[model samples]
Target: MRAVAALARRSVRAGSGRFLVEGPQGVRELVRYAAPSVVDLYVTAAAAQRYAALVESASAAGVFVHSVSDEVLAAMADAETPQGMLAVAQQPEPTLADVLAASPRLLVFLQEVRDPGNLGTVIRAADASGADAVLVTDSSVDVFSPKVVRSTAGSLFHLPVVTGLDAEATLAEVASHGIRTLATEGEAALTLPHVDLAGRHCWVLGTEAQGLPDHLAAACAERVSIPIYGKAESLNLAMAATICLYASAAAQHGTQ
Candidate 1:
């Protein structure tokens, strides 16, 4: 119990080169994916019985499983109500080069994004849109933070997520690959729907409160906005990103 609680801390996770994935969905997907990095699995006794196949699969994958009381499961999880399952796995990271090498046509870059929930939603949206990868700038929140991980609902493991890069340098790097970088702005005259997204596009989103910094916004090849048809002042950061990314996805995939 003490060790499980300790893994909840970021410092401990960092030092141990391992992170916790809570709930049955995340753990089941981890096992289904056959991710070799998963080292440990914890579940409640009832949960083990209910999800016998899942437990068996994890065992077949060679992940050590421990059946404990519901109390122990809660103690290990970051959430108040852990869905009776959790897994400890190594945190995987990829570089800008790795993202580019994949020849991803659609990409989303989270620039200076500080909110863990918003960042996680952004990653999920990116995955849903089938973006090549999601790049999180160095100034963004810890990608592997508990809140972010839970919010992602396991989409964090679905796609290549490049982290800890300078926004400006990443912009330049993707631009060289013929990937036009666009900074999302709520008020910019150029709306997302009107843009020509026939080729690769990397949409860069700023923080929730400040949006993108002026300097970084200026650095992008273009600054584009999502049109607001309703009377709402503005869309939430995650909402705007979804609209922009899907717009690109629709435009590009429609052609293919």
Candidate 2:
């Protein structure tokens, strides 16, 4: 449908409170984790046959499934290889309270990141590292963007990704909950391992270019750096999130 294709634009997806997800993996994950949120599923006839169990599972869950022409599916998809399947689903809604209720011990925040690929990768890293949730602050890429959804592969459905938040307020609130807020600043003297991660912690990462605003970084409990043993210039957003999150995870799990 032309309407589904139009969802490739961030404004359109936001205006409609809906988003389109491509690939069978994302669709299958949606069915498994959040079936009630699915609005409709569109599949090429061949995809319907290839991924018959997914079609059956979605249908059994009461999600509307349509097997259309390959051309129609192509129109609905944004990926170069569309997996011949696409799905429209309501955007996930998770409030700050919802995030806190999960008893989050470790958290990650992206402050004003612009790249959808980076955002999605950070989300996937968060899920793999067993983070409770991820927060994308103001000026960040829209999490529902098709590019972001595609980059997430399926982790977007695995964890709660809180978006469109005020970086200052959210960090303040997280700090109020007795969590140590550590902003990743390359120039900082404290190393990631120097921090006491055995307690609750929240790692705040900045943009690729500007990093965090100076005042925001100052507001955190401490600013730390991931020690670079090699001659690399710096770690990208995804690598930083992955390293910081897993550090906490290892500290928590290994000690147990």
Candidate 3:
């Protein structure tokens, strides 16, 4: 138990790069998708009694289940609800090359997006919208933070998320890949619906408070805005990113 707790806190776990996964839903997904890498599965004694099916499933999958005391479980949990089960599994490494390898054609670059919910929502949207991967530049929240992971609601397992990108290098790399970058601004000439987001594109979303950085904006192939006839000053970063990514998807898929 102590070792499991230590592993959860540390960044490294053998060569697998494991991280702790909490909650019933997350554990279930982990067992289904990453069963082999699951090291220790913990459940409170009461929880074990209540969630017999989950316990059985983990046990059948060769996951070691511990009926920990409530206090022990609480101490290990990052959330308040402490969903009966947690797993330690490998954290897949995603790189720019890997992302491009998946789909060299289109991608989304999230610049300085500080909110975990926003970051996770964008990742989920990227997955659903068929984006290659999400490049999180410096100034964003940690992609693997608990809140971000929870916000993803299991989409974290499906999508590739590359973080810690140097803005200039990222722009250069995307440009080299033939990705035409687009930035969202309040005062852009073209609106999102009018842009030709057909091929090899990178839709860049900016910070919530401030839009894209000047250098990054300059790096873009074009600047576009989401025409808002409503009274709101600006749309939320995640909503705007979703609209932009979907627009690109629509153009690429010929659904526009």
Among these predictions, the greatest TM-score belongs to: 2
Candidate 2 regions with alpha-carbon error over 4 angstroms: none
lDDT of 3: 0.79
Candidate 3: tens digits of C-alpha lDDT, residues 143-189: 76666777777777766788779888888888877788888898898
TM-score of 1: 0.95
* Residue range with the least summed lDDT across 10 consecutive positions in model 1: 26-35
**Regions of model 1 farther than 4 Å from truth:** none
Q: What ranking emerges by TM-score with the best candidate at the front?
A: 2, 1, 3
Q: lDDT values of the candidates? A: 0.86, 0.90, 0.79
Model 1, position 38: C-alpha lDDT score: 92
As for candidate 2, its clashing pairs are none
lDDT comparing candidate 2 with the true structure = 0.90
> Between the candidate structures 2 and 3, which one is better when assessed by lDDT?
2
**Lowest lDDT 10-mer window, candidate 3?**
7-16
Indicate the residue-level lDDT of 30 in model 3: 69
For candidate 1, write residues 89-189 as lDDT tens digits: 88886788988988889999988888889998999999888897999877788888778889998898888888888888888899999889999998799
